[model samples]
Target chain A: MDKKKRIVIQSIATLLQNANLKGFFTGKIYTGQSKGVCVPGLNCYSCPGAIGACPLGSLQNALSAYKFKLPYYVVGLLLFFGTLLGRLICGFLCPFGFLQDLLHRIPFPVKLKHFRLDKYLRYLKYILLVVLVIVLPICVKMTPFFCKYLCPSGTLAGILLSFRNSALFQAYGKLFTWKVIVLAVILVAGVMIARPFCKYLCPLGAIYGPLNKVSLYRMECDASKCISCGKCSAVCEMCVDPTKDANSAECIRCLQCVHECPTKALRAGIKSKPETSKPSHEGEKVPEGRMRGKD
Target chain B: MRRIGTIICFGISFLLIALGILDHQFQAVLAKAAKVCLECIGIG
Candidate 1:
């Protein structure tokens, strides 16, 4: 998107606060506080000032409480965002993702791709999303299983809200210790990898990924007019191999494809006919200091 | 087909939840089936 359009969307995101949701995130009780512009992403449901239920948490609750599936408001919201903005939310909206990006920029000078554990741990998020967020809630009669057990968001939120409600603090026990351990691990991992949670465990990513193929917003590759020079893939923070497939489930639709394409061959939400051109598979040299903005 | 599948799967989940809500028996059946499946896999 152009600069003016980008500014407008960002201002909307910044200005649109679900006040009730914010209050909810700030408090311990669910007052059904339903106000605020819910930024579509994997946010902490229990976050003080979180107006909407974390989609993952809601999914877990729906599974455990009713012993069946519940309404998927979270998925709908996420798809809406994915349709409208793609992974621009990661760059511009999600507070957690934003935090991770900021931490990575912390000048401590850490090498990201150098560690095997960093690469391998990405899959753990997927496993966590499936097993902790989905399966355990269904099987164990637990509400917000991932939040209760594994979420760093929960730990952060708990630290803030528990101060206001002493009863909540008093309620902390061995399970809390376990959650703390998980939080410590997650924190360490976050410091190491760019987005350990999103890469490995975010079910929201799993959902958003499939939608990228069909969403109004997308990261698209022109198969016909393309050289497979991996310039697009080289600079991608999400580690998407844009040349192999631009809209792969692994891709967050960040539009690095569009920005990095030296030939200007990539785009968002393809509607144009494929040009009758040769397929070039040689990885091209990626340019530096790239930026692409979207709503 | 995928949309239909999503709807069907979601519908079944609601049915299970509705049944479970109305009857602990259904919950028992669900929990039982799940536990048994898990145990069979040595997950317990």
Candidate 2:
């Protein structure tokens, strides 16, 4: 059921990401006012078909111009998404995350368990957020270091759009060569490790990770119904043990565990408390269903 | 306590967004978006 929902949501997100179909064919970007607002996902702002700004790109641009103005709007937008949905955006909305999911489904040899190195490397995203996205852009006079030098999403978008315009190949240089190498590494690593970018290097994920602890939408577990089967932890892609910490910063709220639980102990919702109801109330003696419904 | 914190954060974010709209900051964002971002296109 969750897989079907994921497919539907991913399809809609892909459509929204490429809503400007004409731009894809013409090799032109959407210049409408809608482009001014950032999408709540890791989409490339320069994608010819992208109709909205990328939050990471927008943040860097605002930071670059910090000497003259404050980035209240972009910051506010980021805060809104973070506080409301947290990494649910990463799980359900991000095109790059969706791409990683598709790649992992290709029947390749994948890393099933987390390693010590992986845990340590997860902190790199925060460093990337602090340095490339914020520091370098401001220091280097408005140059978006992360977009130009690092982001595989931007590189992939540039590649797709460049295919539409052969003249772009003529303008490619050393920087583009470096970006291609970076994109290649990320692509190969993505196939081996689930969400390598989100787990290790996406600055956008960095911004949303800490917010997951306090986001309104959350994962909750009913300890009373839990059978200690470790199924939820085993199914988690991000190496989070949902039983130990249902609202872990690493959890994307994908609901795979909620679907897999035998006792129906796991749930994802905006509610403050985890529901502890039995899967079937037919055996209860007090006709508790009607009484509970009143609450 | 956490719920209250979340509400406060949301309130601050909404206020800032409203202020941005009133200040016409969207124009600046539009100006940035109208031009193709060279760095993002892998040319700059």
Candidate 3:
């Protein structure tokens, strides 16, 4: 998909998920029947306009109540989404991902595509998934650690809701301040980097990342048509080489590489077999910086 | 094989979602989501 089409899809998805317009004016969360179901992206349930539950938030909350029973509904919904679309949700649905995309579009002096720490930092989201989203919630009863402490979407919701609710504003403490700082840092980093949060911090992205390889909606590279022109890699902000690994976990299915491929080697769809030609740089250790799109 | 994997995943997810509903898990989610979610908003 082109940038404009993707942006439109993102906007529509965001609007549909948060369709409770009256709640925004009233400063109240939607308590409708739809709230029981989970949205495919990283939308916060506490947001005044949210009509559905957030998958990660529901998972953490369910884990907190683990002794009672497993969170089958939330886990099943997550698996359903992962198997169906993988990080395609991150690519075209997530409000926060859209926000990051918009922020990255702001004209900036320096755009850091890759740094020395990039590879190591990519593992942080997985660590957070295992720790904050699962372990801590199970250990501490009824505490959704990720939502309370780390979720910028939740923080954003709090900020938006507090604007109309004086009581909520009065309840702010150091935790809120800390969350605001985290949000500020992430937003600023997003301006310099394409998707710093999705790359290094989002637990939801971590969950969907590995599923990209097996998801029904997947990327296929036709080796028979490849010219090894390296245009796909140059255009990928996520630092994935579509020719080398079309269904890479790091790919969010942005389709920029597919659109940019001069030879039309890369295509994305459901149930297509991916074929990769030998990379020109095969058998040689590529420098980390160069491999990850360093300028 | 990939198609089989996808079908199996779909089957499992549907079964799990059904079982969750039977277990009244949907009600739990609804109840929690209906509230202000103070912790989520960083108010509690």
TM-score of each: 0.68, 0.91, 0.92
lDDT of 2 by residue, A81-123 (tens): 9999989999999998998888777777555557779889988
Q: Of 1 and 3, which scores higher on DockQ?
A: 3
Stretches of candidate 3 off by over 4 Å are: A271-295
Top TM-score model: 3
Which pairs in model 3 have colliding backbones? Answer: none
Badly placed stretches (over 4 Å) of model 1 are: A1-39, A66-92, A114-120, A223-229, A270-295, B1-44
Residues forming the 10-long window of minimal summed lDDT in candidate 1 chain A: A286-295
A77: Cα error in model 3, Å: 0.3
lDDT by residue for model 1 over A1-295, one digit each (tens)?
Answer: 4334544544454334223444444455333424112346555544554554454555565567654644344344445565555556655555565556545555555747446675676566677778877788788874556666666665766666676756667767777677677667756767766666677776667666555554445555665446667887887767777766666666655454577687776787534333443434454433321212211
| Candidate 3, CAPRI quality class derived from DockQ | medium
Cα distance off (Å), candidate 1, residue A96: 1.9
Q: Rate the local accuracy (lDDT) of all candidates.
A: 0.54, 0.80, 0.87
Best by lDDT: 3
Is candidate 1 or 2 superior in lDDT? 2
Model 1 interface CAPRI class: incorrect
What TM-score would you give candidate 2 relative to the actual structure?
0.91
The ten-residue window of minimal lDDT in model 2 chain A covers A286-295
Q: What is the lDDT, from 0 to 100, of the residue A193 in candidate 3?
A: 97
